[model samples]
Target: MVLTPSSAPSRAPSYAAVLRTPHAACPFAAALLGRLSYGVAPLSLLLALKDATGSYSVAGVAMALFGAASVTLSPARAALIDRYGPRRVLPPMAGLYAALLTVIALATWNPGAPALLLGGLTMAAGACTPPLGPVMRALWSSLVPDRELLQRAYSLDGVAEELMYVTAPLLVGIVVTFTEPAAGVLAGAVLVFVGASALVSSPAVSRAHTARPPAGGPAGPRLHGIAALRHAVLVTAAVGLCLGALDLLVVAFTERLHQAAAVSWVLAALSAGSAVGGLAYGAVRWKSSSRVRLPVVAAALGAALLVAGVSPHLYALVAVVAVAGLFVAPALTTAYLIADESVDAARRTQAGAWVNTAFNAGSSGGTAVVGLLVDRLPIALCFGLAAAPALVCAAAVARAGARRPRTAGTGAAGRDAVSGA
Candidate 1:
């Protein structure tokens, strides 16, 4: 069933042919819009709650509740999509998100109702979060006939992810700062509802649904679950945990310095560094499989974490963080690629969801642990704590390499052949 350029359709496509293609530019555009909407909600929720309650602590709590709910429900939501097509499920989910957003806006203006409405809205929205990345990946797999084209497609996706975080927040911030922050939340809800609906309605997505195998047939290769149990997955999860710990460490440092506003600048610097790294990695012609690249990048990340822990000054910490972040996209992209390569085509969505869930769970756990450390000891200790777990992750990866040896000669070919959903 392996596909190649020689097996592709013979004519230059007309508009109809382009429209019917499973993976096309339009679907990618739709995915971008949907992700943009999801990114805007957090800032909006915090602002709306703060404006109404005049309690920053209460607003923070509301945000936490929303995150908790999303973390708990996202897997079930993803599973539902696996059982039923996204086209059938997305519209109603989007509609639910819109209605709950209205409820949150109403609650913001009313003092009687609790801020819990905001949390509920966040959970609903997150639960219904369009499987944009997964869906697009699947589409690309179906449409493109060549492995090189798929790599290029995934590289484009990596670029889109960087763009989403960059532009999404700035635009959201502008709207929130100028108009009512609640308006920003309303806008995000509308975008989610509209964008997701449009994506599902697209001919590309519809075709994927129609292409499903018979219900009772033996399912496609289940790579994600198998990959999840592998050492690579554990190492990747550990990397996520380290990043989360780093986040808490920054917060602790800011609090200790009594310049909490610096958090925004520091985080931005780290993100900027990651953007650079992603671009660099995407551009390079590496002769190594994802297995080789992942462990090496992760070990490098651990070393960077070690440096961050030892650094005393804020400037030094920022530098180290930026350095570490430079490889963030490559690490994430590789981990996802591995997950996709391991799973069956039909089960790709579920596998992707599981990978997302694992990363989130690891990060949340890291945040909790680091937060506790910050509360108990000096802020410097928080940064130091980040390195310990990173070292452990590095060790786990090294051990995995010893146990499941990879031939150096086949590495490049294996990496080049990466086929993602």
Candidate 2:
């Protein structure tokens, strides 16, 4: 079912068209269900630990352990998926994660759970957490070979994930209001297990598996095709670093204005702008390949952030932040698209994982680094400094992308990549 431009939708593909691809809806929904756990489980864990330990410091430490394990090991988990295929690997991982969460929930259900126990179990849970998001992105590359439709799909995914995070905390709020926060952890356990079960059942997942190389050797062929991923990961990290700084910078901006209540609105605007930008960017029919487009979008985001701190009023800052947000999803979407193009189907999950890892690691770094600078430097100047990474990284990517030659056909010739959607 390999599809060419003539067989696929027009240059500007709609999200609806992307979803309508054969056997797409069910697995995608299943992946989202699993991903919802991701949005909910962490917050629930934080709350549960806080309730159990009666100490914010203890809760923070446990949560930090969980996040670090999850982010740091994402690529390794994805490598397993890449080697064994999602259908084979995702279920076991999800099952283990759900079981660990159940144990965590029970341990915290009555409070007085030992900190040592909680920390160990949470980290173990994170380590076993299935790489659902990366798998789903790889699946998209499998189901939709047409690059245009795939772009639309990734954009749709980023927006959906954004919404999931926005709503997940509210779900936690409701659960905790009525019962123990430990109950929220139990709920997450249910969600992920059910989602993974259903996702692996999809016919589309059958197509996700590729011929694996012999074990005991490095990913021989898979590693060869992924050279282009270097630039994608680099720019993605820079974008993530900028975004991580923005969280604190926005807080500083609000504090300076003595308008703490406005912080939520500014953050909301950023999310909204990103959602809008993602959809728009996906629907556009770009002639350039993603290798070139990646750096361009990264640069746009950097430029917006560079001038955002100069805003004199809350309203102005919000507007500029919103504008900066416009580039956020597009940059991520484009980066994922680059991963899709650079890696073959067998290695696709790992490819996505690497991008995710870089972005998340950069975000952690940005938050810590920006915390140090917010006190010493002017807020505006801090904003400018934050922009430096994106600008500098984008130039590096631009140079690398320039040296690479464009593909002759649909950008999937050698990679066995996207066919249609």
TM-scores for every candidate against the unseen true structure:
0.83, 0.91
* Segments of candidate 1 deviating more than 4 angstroms: 1-23, 116-125, 212-219, 222-225, 228-232, 254-260, 378-380, 405-412, 415-421
Residue-wise C-alpha lDDT for candidate 2, range 38-94, written one tens digit per residue: 888989999999989999999988878888999999999999888877788888899
- Whole-structure CA lDDT of model 1: 0.67
Residue 48, model 1: lDDT of 83
lDDT of 2: 0.83
Q: How far is each candidate from the true structure, as Cα RMSD in Å?
A: 5.9, 4.2
* Top candidate (lDDT): 2
Candidate 1, 56-94: lDDT as tens digits: 888888777777666666657665666687888777877
